[model samples]
Target chain A: MTVQLQRSATVAGPVRRVRRSKHRPIWEEQPTIAGYVGKTVALTLIVLAVLYPLYTIVLTSISTQATINAAGGLVTVPGEITFAAYRQILSGGIVTRATLVSIGITAVGTLLSTTVSVLCAYGLSRPNSFAHRPILFLLLATMFFGAGMIPTYLLVSHLGLIDSYWALILPTAVSAFNVLIVRNFFMGIDQAITDAARIDGAGEWRVLGQIVLPMSKAVTAVVALFYGVGYWNAFFNAMLYINDNSKWPLQLVLRSYVLQGVTLPGSGVGQVDVASGAVTGLPVKMAVVVMAIVPVLIVYPFVQRHFTKGVIFGAIKG
Target chain B: MSKQVADAAPARPAGTAQRGTADGGPGGRRRRPVTGTAHRRTSASVPVRKVSMWAQIKRDRSLLLMTVPVIVLLAVFAYVPMAGNIIAWQDYSPYVGIVDSPFVAWDNFERVFTNPLFLNAVKNTLLITAFQLVFFFPIPIALALLLNSVITPAIRTTIQSIVYLPHFFSWVIVVTVFQQIFGGASQLHRILAGHGVHFDLMTDPDTFLILITSQAVWKDAGWGIIIFLAALSTVDPALYEAAVVDGASRRRRTWHVTLPALRPVIILLLILRLGDALTVGFEQLILQRGAVGPGAAEVIDTYVYYQGVIAGDWSFAAAAGLVKGVVSMLLVLGANKLAHVFGEAGVYQRA
Candidate 1:
């Protein structure tokens, strides 16, 4: 957390100090007025490019059919605001069930993935270990070369995981990327503490459960957040394996809703505007997007401080 | 790497000759030249079996025991599936199971080579990946340099956070957001058309590639900057000070100092890009296929999904997947080897 603060403080303090010095050398000081104008213009353009589409999405979500037709489309603001879209989507059985299923899968999947990944990572990181090298190689090889989808699907189907909750959770329980990150983190812990545990005649399981697990809150939290997001965003596996509508995750449901644009019987978007294919004028799609993403968006900010460090493990040196 | 470690194992009897021949003293295994008395030896001796392989393993039992579950898991999942790659050569049918499926020799590979869709998928996958490398790769580095030079901290962090937001959005949400903003019912087109200036991007075929690439940059550019920024931070400030003392201009200093400093990271990231060259955002392409059509958007992963999953030809799909997997692995290994030739520690140490 302090890393972000410390970075800003260092960058700003030096630049500000150099700017105020009347006698400072031109080469060492900050840029001139023209340069400032150029940088400002460029930054403004970049910001607008990033934000405009998002602004349009939000604007369209609130606009009525009349407003959409009158404007021909929206850019900044809608002519009118309404909650009909939100009410309609929520009232619909598809969105509600999809939302609930997504929540259940994400919550349970994150817990299982994080726990298994951490235990496996911690186990592999121990020194002088029999299984360490071979297992690490196994994990790393999978990162480079997966067995592709056919075998994976066959494996899942063979296990009778088809149409079950396990179909989503089991195949994805321990991501090699997350395991590597957690293992690297465990290796960074002080050896003296682990040595003390050995001196106390503690077993490998006891030392892991009692000592290493307790102190790795940051990485543990980061890994859990990663798994949570992965589970929430997962669509392909569910799309392929899960035929049971009741077990459909949110992303798959959203895909069908957005792409097929076919509203189910109780979806409350009111009488098929079948002529247009899409609910053509309705904002239920935006509502679906919000429903799918709101959980992670809410959770991310709490753990945002670790985001940079957590994901950048192998990028720099690999 | 594990192979190297396995070869160097201390417990292996193969190392005993090297160990014994190198050192022949109290810690080594050779008769003492000066000690003639067996009684004296018995009083001072430590048991040789204590240093034996079985005893060494026992002493390190805690470490060995800790890694059991990891080994078991990997054996069951990763290694087992690798063994399943034998199916790539077969006419693998689910009804018959992996073992029972009759071997079809090179038929799958032959089918993949002859199929127009598979060839198009390869071309499309490479094209999109190359576009990403060309347009999307360097923006983050440029953005990081700009953000690094900002005089304000709060503004910098806020912008950074905002830019990183799209990365967390699912591809479905990202595509939906774009459709809402620019599709046939797009608000921007409506706003422009109201002023008698019609601008339509949703249906424009030529502009679709640029739109997809830009969307990719918007989503990933900020997140990607973390690596470049980490590299930038490690550059010595003294080098900049020296350049300043020599009257180097700001632009000159950045080029001569910062860019050179970031070269290793830039190269490393490029190598990674090469490794992931076969993967061109599968979900992104699949989601937008309706708008852009399969010609521009079809890639290897999507093609496999369509051919195998949608068309129900598991063997052909498996063949396409195998080709991609093999080509990508070769590309990475070759890149790693070249990196070593350039005097960098490539993915691992060379024996």
Candidate 2:
């Protein structure tokens, strides 16, 4: 029965195989005349639909203030290009401060969260431990029931975390879902390697740090990206917990820009205060959207491959 | 939603490991040394046979030690706050505190149940979730099927990368993107107005559900492609080859072979989605609330925000949140059981 399962796994699994399809003839594989045309049209439509809206955002962001307003909103082309909008949003103190705050929070928060996840996951994956069942049940129960938000807020407030960065970090630092994913990945490690380490007199932490993690880099990277992206995109907690404008993350700042329809340029605000007395501000607002998304957009292409790999390896039953 | 996603992993591991150990060690480890030398086994090998719970504890002592901080944190922040659900039955005041507050005993729940506004939010949530399960769920499967059929790795990877980019975008950006094209500044709006037409969907309460659902699709559909893609790889190539030899059309082969092969995955994903129906994306609703107002866009999470946190009525907010949490938990449990009853693997064991 075990041998049958092993055979099926190798035959069916996608990740294990590396193939060279040299046996197939390229010319014969080429689609017939009608099929070629259909494929081309379908591909073209898919590409256009995805690209056009993104292109419009880029086009508007680079458009000059005068041209954008003159066009009565963005059109096919910007007619002129200017970096003044970006300069205005960037140089202004609000976005600058918020960008730094978001960076600091994401960096520190990701490290802290990932570290705790690794520790707990390593602990939970052990065969039998004193704290295993109780700890596991406690965490599992958390997945079902939470103290709700008010009790959570009261708890944080009671701890004097209100108006502090800890408010953003502490409550959300260790995700139960993320922990399970990492733990699953750890469990996938060859038991022989861990047993060999144990025979060599290595402690649990040493075995994890020296053996398990190095082999588990792919999943760890995925978890870090997940945690990091979540931290960077998080603004609700900041909005709810922190009242001070100086400490607001970029999302909250962007939200305010959208709400007020204001474009504050060169003063550090991405969206100008059109309502406050600025003319031709839509370009600036477009620039703010561009500014808000660019960092994550840059990081995304690098991590996309590993993202699904990590999720699948963690999600499926072995 | 929280319970659904979280509970699935735990129940599987806990059940399998406990049963696997009791029956004998996992099959692989059991086959090794003991079979080679039954009576000649060293004391070290025999020690496992005498395994007491305390011995297991001693073996995993360091691991147990490391799990301490995690347990404490989850207990205090995650579980302890659950007790605050009592406030949902009371008139909770921050100044008066949870203890001294007047116990309204279901008044908040009664108000939520009776109010037309609250009922609308529930209706909207269910409607949007149902639409999501139908219109949105299958796109990714179709996409994964398409991608799997494509032999070109470069094209597949590039498309996947571009599509997945939206997953990381903040709800603020997603809503802003929608507003840019559909709001006052939208290219479509200008084009329509140029052609002597007018349409306002962004602020139109009637169309808000469609708008929100589309935004959700745009943001998450690519991410959903992952699971379907994973499941598709498990389909037997032999099945496709047999169909091809029988002169089957590509579409027919896919329909007969591929779709049937995806049954387990489809059922499993459906159960998961039902479990997550309550959590209809918190940040998205909050961002769009001002435009659509409470009439079309208010939800359980946003309601808690406005009533409890924003209004400083902590008790009422606590109650609303508790109801959502409990309802979501029950939904996942029921969904898992239903999946099992249908001869599918539920979140946990087969039975």
Candidate 3:
């Protein structure tokens, strides 16, 4: 890798140009040292801005009660660490229950959302399939116009879905934007292939299952990730629809404990850890935040590359 | 994305779906021979037939059937809720239901327009939107340009992975993360207070705009860059080569080549941003409203939720939300029309 280039930067523009050509093309000019330093510093700051908060959260969550107290709020430089917070929270407390609830919601919601979107997308994807234009319009219309918050809540309630998981899943499961993304991906597939399949006596179902979906796995994965993340991260809908604390997703739990400073209930962290003053609710709160985030972290890496394919639908991004 | 397309394109039409094809039933016999011409001619231009409506429905029944579930879900949820906006004019009582609720005509609207709380919400909503549009919107554009200049793919990808992580986190988590960093007893607060600079960022009303806008940027700005990067990817390298060969400097090349290529996408996004100007992070604002107080934090969404869902003043809240929705729609249309006037495609082109 190092064999291809010169490293003399102090020389004139021609010599500097030779060194830069390994990284940049010959047509591009050498970046000034000022620009180089500025870019490096800016990139470092941007990366740190994201990384530092995360590091502190992880550190603070794992730090011992003694360590947390010693280091004070948000332990940047780590000391003694413990899993007591993770154990206590994940050990059949309200946090554990909320985690389970979030898992269930994310799993079922992602599946349902992906299926409906894919089916509807493929259905409307055929270039001149009967009534496809009208159907596409029907789905697309939802993107630009909508009933606001109150009416949607009223509708869900009217459906008797209040405090139900269906309130979380069903109302938002098949968003039109998701449908459009999938549809756009489907449209990008060569029509010749689908047409050839049709001539080979394959039904639309077979074409979708056998041919189209397998080809468009990138968009499918991306759309699924979108819905899964949406479901996982959603708290507003739960707040509106669910009054029962038991139905609260990890987000609402995080909101109450971390954001609102509501002491955890059903083995409240504040209640048990009082005498020591070491295990104040900060670790518990941060642990819940971590739990809420971990799924997205786990799944995101796998789906990371598919997003460009997903948002290739300029309709959604723009 | 290029890698995926390359892999997927080569793998397609390989007779891989043996089970799927074997399981299919009665496709060749029942449907028209409209597709019969497809295999003979390598081209996709199939001859057309004038089929009756019934024939078309019968032919496409399975495709139509596939769309039914989505249609049902949208109808029951989206369209039904939209229809339920009637309650804005009605004195909607949950006990009475929409069927029995007394239609109060312009009563709710009249009250909503006059109510100081609603006005405060509207003002807050507009301020947040304007602030975000000015401050938050250009961040992704600039970042995309910077990241695109980053010649090393590994470095660029690593940065992207780190930044996009928070976009997947809930607003609750985003708020909590910010709290851990900037809360009353946060590291920054503690550090600052030790220097005799005591201030609580969470509760302060004055810097709430900056605080929330920064939050929005942190949450979304990374993910927002993806689309711009995609747009930038489509810009031909030859254009840059030509610009450089013609003695265009870096700044001039960017101005002439990069900015022009991004202009359509930027305009389209601007139109969309204006369309969604009123929706300035409902969940974000709602989570912080108690801390910052509603005076600074309450926007149309939170106001609607508070007055309707929280306070049980459904009609008044519905009226407020209805006005916001209508205004949002008008903004999208107006902005789209403006884009068309300037010879740019907005969300969609004119029919």
Task: Tell me the DockQ of each model, to 2 decimals.
Answer: 0.30, 0.33, 0.54
Q: Where does candidate 1 chain A have its weakest 10-residue lDDT segment?
A: A17-26
* CA lDDT, every model vs. true structure: 0.72, 0.72, 0.81
Give fnat (model 2). Answer: 0.53
- Give stretches of model 1 more than 4 Å off: A1-27, A59-75, A78-82, A269-281, B1-73, B190-205
Count clashing residue pairs in model 3.
Answer: 0
Q: Tens digit of lDDT per residue, candidate 2, span A1-318?
A: 346445544544454233323322221123455765676576666556556667777787788866776666664665888887677777757877888888888889989888888889899997655556677767777776666777888888878888898888888887888888888888888899987987676767788889999998878888888998888888789888889878888878888865446444446444344553332566667777777788887777677778767888777652
B1-351: candidate 3 lDDT, tens digit per residue: 211211222112223322233332433323333434223433345344444343345456667778989998988888888898999989999999899999999999999999998899889988988888899999999999999888777898999888787788888888888877788767678789899998988889999999998898898899889888888989988799899999999999999999999999899899988999888888888889999998999988898888999899998989889898899989999999999999987888645
Candidate 2 residue-wise lDDT, B1-351, digit = tens = 211211222222232224213112233332332222232433455554454333344345557656766776776777667776777888877788778988877798887778676677777778778878888888778777766666566777777777777888888888888887788656677688799877767888888878887887788877777777788778776677678778777778778988887788788788778877877888998888887888778877888788777888676677678778888889888987888888887666631
lDDT of 1 by residue, A1-318 (tens): 346445545555565733433322233666788877898898888788777766766666677767655555452565788767777777748788888888899899988788778877887786655546766777788878877776677677777888998788877777888888888878878989986985676665677889998888777888898888888998888988999876788898888776556565667432346565344545666666667767877988877777666656534322
DockQ-derived CAPRI band for the predicted complex in model 3? medium
Name the Cα RMSD for model 1.
Answer: 8.1
Question: Candidates 1 and 2: which is better by TM-score?
Answer: 2
lDDT of 1: 0.72
Worst 10 residues of 3 chain A by lDDT: A1-10
